[model samples]
Target: MSSFRLTLERRQQVSTLRSTTTYILGLLLGLGFGLLVLLSAGAPAATLLDDLVIQVFFSAMGLAQTLTLAVPLILVGLAATSAMRLRFWNVGIEGQLWLGAIGATLVALSDFGSESLRLPTMLLASAIAGAAWIAVPLILKLRAGVNELVVTLLLSNVAYLLLQHLLFGAWKDPVNSFPVSPRFDENEQLASLGFGNLHSGIYVALGITLLMTILVQKSRTGFYVDVIGRNRTTALATGIPVTATITLMILLSGALAGLAGGLIVIGVEHRLTQTIGINTTFSGIVIAFIARFNPLAVLPTAIVLAGIYNAGGTLKVFYGIPDAIVVLIQGMVLLTLLMVQFFSSYRVSLLRQSAQQPGQPST
Candidate 1:
């Protein structure tokens, strides 16, 4: 009698063709899985494709909304990519964004700069605030060798609490009696691009994405980051300024995350609210993973995710399905893509063995 066992062997080198094929396959599988999830959630199967694909991507209104929503998603995706490049998981992205919002809010309320320079000043303050917020976890990680992941994740709660304190207390709007800040002046808000809900902030997000791509793919710091991500010991052996390089990248990450928050306030929300960074960090992380942490890929990945989010709304309106179903679909897609990555890096095979009595001779 023979028994067969399955084994997975790591691939020493994966070809470009195989990689591309696996990526496409993963996307298809993920979409199929999402469809199944929708079907189970009581979505009308006949119109699912039309609502999810045509209505979301083909129509002018849907395209505009998706692109508008993609703005912050792109920023967060870039932020996550920057940190992941150095193996620094900045899980406190939500906190950094909130701090960025706070910074921008301060500028708006104080009328800190000339009308012409006010928006620019607010942007600068936002980036600085974001970098400052993440510095706490980065410092502990560098100096005490603490896990940046844990520290960053915990710090997010602190940031949220601070945001709540401001909203419910000092920052509350007096006239409306709302837990929100005063509306931003017209000069402080992002200019509309005359395209549905789209704003000039889309241009800003695109510019930052292009700059980040260059910084990561063309600059010397990027090379150092790649080396460090592969092996810190090797990076140090090669005389790379490990500490300084990480500090730069992680700060950059925080800045981008913070910038996203600022964009939401000035570009979309026009005021600070407690709802500012809700669940956005996780979506950004998903976008980064979907893009395989490539800066340029973040744009397209963000658009796809924005569509999924829009589709979720469609489901709610058309089929009365809850928002939680969309979350479940997103989770399923991420899980599927992860499995594809694993299979792409390894090959599975079966081995057979024959069993015989203790004294019997094997043929």
Candidate 2:
């Protein structure tokens, strides 16, 4: 008689082609599973698939809306990537985003700059605010040896409360008596690009993506990030300015998240509201992980996510599918991808146990 045991082993090397194929397979499997789930729930599978494909990709209006959503998604994804490179867990991206929005709102409401300069001023202020918001957690982590994850997560609640206070008290729109800031001035708002809900902010998002790609792929900072991520102790011993690099990357992460908030206000919402950047933290983390934390991959990943969000909305509006089901489907897709990613890096093997065990028992 022979007995076998299952063993898990990490792959020594995974080719790019193989890795990509596995991820693609994972996506197909996830989508297929989602289809089955919807069908089981009595959804109109035939028309639903067609509508999802047409509306998310083929239709001009759908593509426009997707691009609009992708702008901030791209920004937030970059934010996560920035922190991830340094092995920093920036769980407060939502809080940083709110701070960014607040910064932009202050500029818009106070008329801080001339009409011609208002938009630029708001953009600058938003980035600064985001950086400032993250600085607290970064300091605590670096100086006080605190856990940034907990601090950042807690700060998100604080940021939300602050946003609520401002909206309900100081910034409420007097005309509508709503818990929202005054609409941005024409000059302060991101201008339309002659498309459905698409705005000039897409250009900014694209440009930033390009810059980040360059930084991540070609710069010393990128090299430092990789080294630090692999081994922080080795990075410090090898004369890499680990502390400075960590600080820079974390701050960059916060700034990018903040910029997304500012962009949402001027580019999408055109005003600050309590609902601004809702679910952004999860979306950012999802996009970052799906893209494998590659800056160049963030754009396409963001578009795909934006399409899912758009499709989810369509399902709710057309089919009356509950939000919970949509969330579950999203979770399934993410979970599938994660499982596939894990398998790509590892393999399980069955090994036969040696017969010597019987001789040893006899002895």
Candidate 3:
């Protein structure tokens, strides 16, 4: 008897050089596919190229807006990366972000804090709210064997509804018909960086990104997280505190998302409006994946995504290109990256069984 078999085995260790190459190739392929789509949509190739290189990226304060948008995207990327690194799916990043804004808004509206204490207190409140939002799901995950992914996603809607309730009801600005909170005091807002719409939040985002990169690449806790992610059984056998590590990571992830929310409120919007919530959660997920969940890579990835977001609006106005085109490109990038990851991580082999010599089962 004979049998044919196909198998896939992971590489014992993949080199950083090879990993980088794979990512670059994936990015090129994604852009190429996006170009084809644009061509099919009646876009002129020369103008497309010009807009992509100049107007969308560098012209007319484009870079500043891109960097500003990147602030929250970077934090959201870090939050998603932390949970994903542990093989845990924290899809509630959007919810955590909204909770952060809520926390910040509550503090901003309160009269208990002194003017000097306002900003710090608001940020702290945001972080705590984000962490607390995740804590409920974490309990479900650990004790009830529930899946965090579904819980987090559903909770995101809840966060949105909660935000709407406050905005349309209590937080509604009396002077205007809009469902928005009062403008934040100058002392409570983040200091500007003397750039177009850019603020100190960018520095905060960069600092956090660097710190996360160091923690993941050069620390013992990072090693433990890696082991647990690779093999839970092995991690447990090696005396790693899998439960505690998971808990810590979950809380940290939520806190980072909350920080993003606070940053958006304090730095950009300056008020809680009906539209002022985590609209970039999907974009952050894209950034994290494009960076291969590497904390160090997340910064550049976030910048790239932020460019697309900022530029897409420009394209809509100047080139008449719909916003959906940008979305199509993002989709292509995500799909191509997944394909690249699969090919780079595993190899398939075919085998044929030898003829059986006895009555025993064929081997």
Candidate 4:
């Protein structure tokens, strides 16, 4: 019994370590492939690698840019993590983000004179809007027994159409002749850090990450969510409010996704546009998957992804590499990580002598 318990504990420890180790291996493989591509392009692979390392680790400005890019990624990653934890697939984070941006745009356009109320109102509206956008799919799943995956994906396209409609019709800047919403009020803009283009959104993202970590690790609601995720029928049998738990989890995920959209507008874009939501939903999925759906792990994963993004611009300018190279690297990294997960979670072993003999008798 003692040895059996020790073996169990050791297995658990190995499983936990497997996730971190696999992620590191995946990143290394991605870097290796990137270098191969650089060599094939006739770029100085050594110089490019050195520059990337220096920019990612040694340059203060580079670090700031990375964090700035990571702010939205962190928020959206958390959103994905939340829904995944509840076994709820809220894949419409892209649409939720757009709705959040729309909400923020509405607030920015309104005549809210009080400077104090401006930021808070925008943030609140974004959260509400995000939740409302997700509620559509949630209701469809709960009430009509729809497959959330299809509903969420379709909604993302719908969001794109909505954005285009607003830009070309109602919210078009008549003077500028551009398909973009009106610029945000100056007061509505997120405060910038002294560093390179970093904004208050970084702080907000960090705060949310910490808060979510605590909520998931320490709260009763979090416990119930975990239980429901692992075994919904068991949770219902135990008198846990499984439906309410699912609803809250979906709403929380949507709110986080919305916060990411709000950050994009208030901190980066300062206006809504047709292209604002592009690729963000997919990026969030990558971040969440890379982190293995752990909210706390999402932080470092977001930073790494952000570094990749920043490096892409530098590569484009210096090495004449296309911007698509960065996307390709991200795809490779995700694929490798998934493969590692498969190996870690399963094992194949040879059959015992007696079993093998019986199975091979006919042969």
Scored by TM-score, the top model is 1
Off by over 4 Å in 3: 1-17, 349-363
Candidate 1 Cα errors over 4 Å, as ranges: 1-5, 354-363
Q: Give the TM-score of each candidate.
A: 0.95, 0.94, 0.91, 0.88
lDDT of each: 0.91, 0.89, 0.86, 0.82
lDDT of 1 by residue, 93-192 (tens): 9999999999999999999979999999998899999999999999999899899889989989999999999999988998877799999999999998
C-alpha lDDT (0 to 100) for residue 270 of candidate 1 = 94
By TM-score, is 1 or 3 better? 1
Model 2, position 70: C-alpha lDDT score: 92
Tell me the RMSD of model 1 versus the true structure: 1.9
Candidate 2 lDDT tens digits, 64-159: 988888999999999999998777899899999999999999999999979999998999899999999999999999999999999999999999
lDDT of 2 at 238: 97
Cα lDDT for residue 160, model 4? 74
Cα lDDT, model 1, residue 126: 92
Q: Residue 87 in candidate 2 has what lDDT?
A: 78
- Comparison by lDDT, 1 against 4, better one: 1
lDDT of 4 by residue, 141-243 (tens): 8899898889988988897788788889888877777788888877899998889889988888989999988888889988998899899899999999988
Q: If both were scored by lDDT, which would come out higher, candidate 3 or candidate 4?
A: 3
